[model samples]
Target: MARWPLVPATDAPKNRDPEPPEGEAFPVTSTGLASEQPLRSAAFRWFLAGQSISLAGSAMSPVALAFGVLEVTDSAAWLSAVTTAALVPMVATLLLGGGISDRYRRDIVLRLTSLGAGLTQVGVAILLLTHQHPALLLPLSALNGIFQGLTTPALRGIVSNLAAGRGLQQASSLVASARNATRILGPTTAGLLTASVGGGWAIAADAASFLLAAAFFARMSLPNLPPRTENGPTMLGELREGWSYFSSKPWIWTVTFAFGVFNALNMGVWQILGPVIANETIGAEGWGLVLSARGVGSLLASVVMVKLTVRRPMVPALSSMTLGAVPLILLGVGATTLWLAAAAFVAGVVSEFFTVVWETVWYTHVPERMLSRVGAHDEFWSFVPIPIGQLSTPVLAAAFGTAAVAVTGGGVAAVAMLMPLLVPSLRRIEIKRGGD
Candidate 1:
């Protein structure tokens, strides 16, 4: 293991890079298509291991929770309510969570939040197993959401620390690949556990995964990041600082805005409606296969992204997002399992590609000290509409018909995908090396 010596804020050298000229687009740079494997270091390996364990658990959660809710009451509406309950707090806490990550040791924050999430799930499992009122699960789920929200910014912040300037793209690709691989395994395991033992046991397994992740994270020897240069008077003040930093970069904010709507229409719509369609048209088994195909697509794309490089990354990132609408449209049209699966596979690939490009852009261009807060802003803007979309999609679909809603959402997503390209700054982005 490489020793990470703690450097005090007073001793650390200040960043020497000149800030981009005001009232102009930030200059884009990249590592320019390096095919080297990710750095093999103890800290990086431990961090990756922790993330894999945690993500596997997270992947199982939705399936277990959804089926558990259904077991309690066969109403799709109740399921939505439970999912929304978690999302609301997760979104709400994100800004503050980002600030906290920037202000503290990110790994510690992640450790604590992971522990909280695990315990919260365990509590829910106990409640469910005891045959207590299922309504109790809602508040526990909300508590879990709060921890989930806090985890993101810290995780983002810590990744660069672990990478140690080796290659952010390679690191990001490996992490994405782990997540995608887990998506294939986790849900399938959850389905089996739910069937064989019950939803409670499946959820209990998720709790154990989080505990294991926490243990792995505890072994890391992460470097101490420099303290914030501009400490705000309060949490809100810190958030405003993050916002100022985020908004100053025109390309970043523009893309963030587009994702806000895109996520709403695509992610939100899928979560709310995908299961409904699967239950009605495709059998549950078929839906599982479709989702597995999507995971496979993502896993394959992550592999491609490990080697793929673009001179102008935003072109692919923005253009590829339009593909997200395909599966949604296919589902609305009541397409065959094969057709829906194909479209879903494509959508997943596009989504993963964009994720690599976007993360690489931030890790490369943004100041390391402020990356967590900026990430929070990025996350906040993009995620704000997700819950709204989840809650409202069904209502809108009911009034307008599923086909109309799907097509309209797809149209909006396409527009969002193209709309960012109109910005002169977005069009001009280029990548040289991540964490440059």
Candidate 2:
């Protein structure tokens, strides 16, 4: 097995321009539009194609699964159980997955995990189609979650390698656009499928999407670096090194911690309770439209980001995230479907802007060798609180009323989004021109 060389603390500066690894060639910089630059690389194009298709299907699966659980059990608690089952295992394995991606070839890891996730979705589709107990989706969801955890860190690291140099921001924005566009198509399709064919068929479409994405990944030709000597550090040692690097940076750790708190409050209320409220008021189709409207807003943001440059990225990134609370507040207050969709759209725009800038920060600043492992640490903290939110939200809702619990969560999340800005080091970080 090959071990990745560790980045020395002094050598890895914040805001450093990323260099291509020894074996890899820099992607040709495009003379065309900014968004077109990332498309110049055949590898990134394939990656985008696969990701767009996969995202569309993946987005649909959640709405399908959520409605399916409700259809079968008609209990908010059961919905929480299924979602929490997937999340707990994902949170548990993120560090291990991060380690694996750092230790192995990321493209290969992604291919295998996509295949694994697709197979799990197959199982989910079958269970739903056969009218099996909702409890049966738990194990399959857990299996799928494991694959997702493994996929995330590697996916984050690979983009810089694929796009390289000045193309990083372009790649990031383009990818976000693809993701947001799919969000529009996905939920709308899922709602229609669930309404007409069934949630099982929607899930089956997700399975096919994953399989197709794996095929596209197989077609990409990334360089395979030579293996390290046998005397290299053990996995535990590598992980310790990753943590050391991760924790030493106030900007990295602080932002991650803040988002962790924000996610804890936001995810549960929006995902679990929003659906319940929509079920009662607007119906499944209306909820899907609300989500789709959010996608439209995100898509618009990504387009605008393609040409825009920010010097102090984190300032606006963190500030804009406070808007994420709006949709939740609207949902809590029993706003009409149109009003809820409008609020969701605003939330989507700001959230996508934050995501694009933040990802560009990671690609430009983080050392390539350390990217996956460090990102794993970031993601682990960011996601670890989700299951807690999922499990407790129902109980909290039952006690204080769903509307009250949701409004409270939104308020707390708004505060959490601002906390990272208090760190002095985070405020000083800058993205150099042509670096993003």
Candidate 3:
């Protein structure tokens, strides 16, 4: 890792290269495309190992929780509430927790949150296992949601400090790939575990992932990132400043707005309806195959974008996000057939490509010191729409029908996402594009 200077360095995000005129020659790869960061180093190698374990555990919780809720009560309305109960607190606490990540040693914050998440999982598992007050799982799940909400901004910010400067992009790619890879196992395993053992086993497994995450985070030699500015004296004051920073950048706000609308409609589809569709339509094994197919797609993206030459970072990033809408549209429309779902799964891989590139763009363009706060702002804007989707999907499902609602949501996400794309200032944004 590059030695951290007392004063912060001014490296822009990976994809924010200056753009040339339409007919001009774009800069090709010079230094390299693949990440130059040393992953073989003991510290980062351990960090990678730990993240892998934690993600494996993290994958099991949602499937087990959702299915358990379904087994107890078939009401879609109740399920919506459960989803809301878990998501609201998680998104609500994001900015505050992001502040904490930026101000403190990030690894410590990760460890502490992981410990809490672990405990939440274990406690919920015990409650479910004892067959005592199964209803209590909602509150327990809410607690876990809170930890996850708080962890994301912190984790996203901390990751850059894990590897070398060049490795930053690689780290982002790995994160996306890891998530896709883990999703393939986590839910599949959860389904089997629930089918064979019960929800308790899945939740228990999730708890262990947190404990393992905490242990692994504890050993990191991450550099401390001093905050760029004071968080502020009051809640409103901090919020105003955060908004100021968020609004100052056209690229950031555009991406935030685009995702906000897209995800608001898309999240419920992916989490609730997507799972139900898996159980009823595709079947567990088929769903696993679909998810794995998507994982392979994302893995392909990592291999290609991470190695093959990329030009105009923001354009490709924007293009991927825009293209992402097509796959999502296909996902709901194509749900019935395993072959179609497999195609949709490939669409998901394209979605993930946008996800990783943009994440790297944000982490790189935004000042490192304010990375977490900016991240909180980014997350907050984009995620605000998600809970709305959660609360609304049941009603939409009941009124319009589940398939119709999924189709509508998918359509809405795509349409709403384009509002930002139409803005030339946003679409033309050329931050740090090109390779390492």
Comparison by TM-score, 1 against 3, better one: 1
lDDT of 3 by residue, 1-436 (tens): 2221122235533223333333122232221222346365555666677778888887777788777666666556666677767788898888887777666777788888899999998997787677655467688778988898888888777655664444656776776667767877788899999999888778888899899988988887565443445443454554455566678666678878888888877777766677776677677777666667767777677655554334445565555555555544555665455664566555676676677667665555555545677789888888898778776887778788777777777777766656666655445433343342
lDDT of 1 at 49: 94
Return the TM-score for each candidate structure. 0.87, 0.84, 0.79
lDDT, residue 257, model 3: 83
Q: Using lDDT, give the best candidate's number.
A: 2
To one decimal, what is the Cα RMSD in angstroms of model 3 from the true structure? 6.9
Per-model C-alpha lDDT, please?
0.79, 0.81, 0.68
When 1 and 2 are scored with lDDT, the better candidate is 2
Worst 10 residues of 1 by lDDT: 24-33
C-alpha lDDT of candidate 3 relative to the true structure: 0.68
**lDDT tens digits, residue span 1-436, model 2:** 2222335658864423344332222343322222336787677888889888888888898889888777777888988888878877887888887778777777788889889999999999999888889889899999998999888888878787687555677788998998888777787799999999888888999999999999898876566645767777678877887888788777789889888888888879988898999999889989988987888899999999888888787888899899999888888888999998998898989999999888887876676677788999999999888778877999999999999998889988998889889976666556666633
> What does candidate 1's lDDT look like per residue over 143-221, in tens digits?
9999989999998767666553336677888999999999899988999999998888889999999988988888875
Residue 34 lDDT (model 1): 23
lDDT of 1: 0.79
CA-only RMSD, every prediction: 6.5, 6.0, 6.9
Selected candidate, larger TM-score, 1 vs 2: 1
Summing lDDT over every window of 10 consecutive residues in candidate 3, give the lowest-scoring window: 25-34
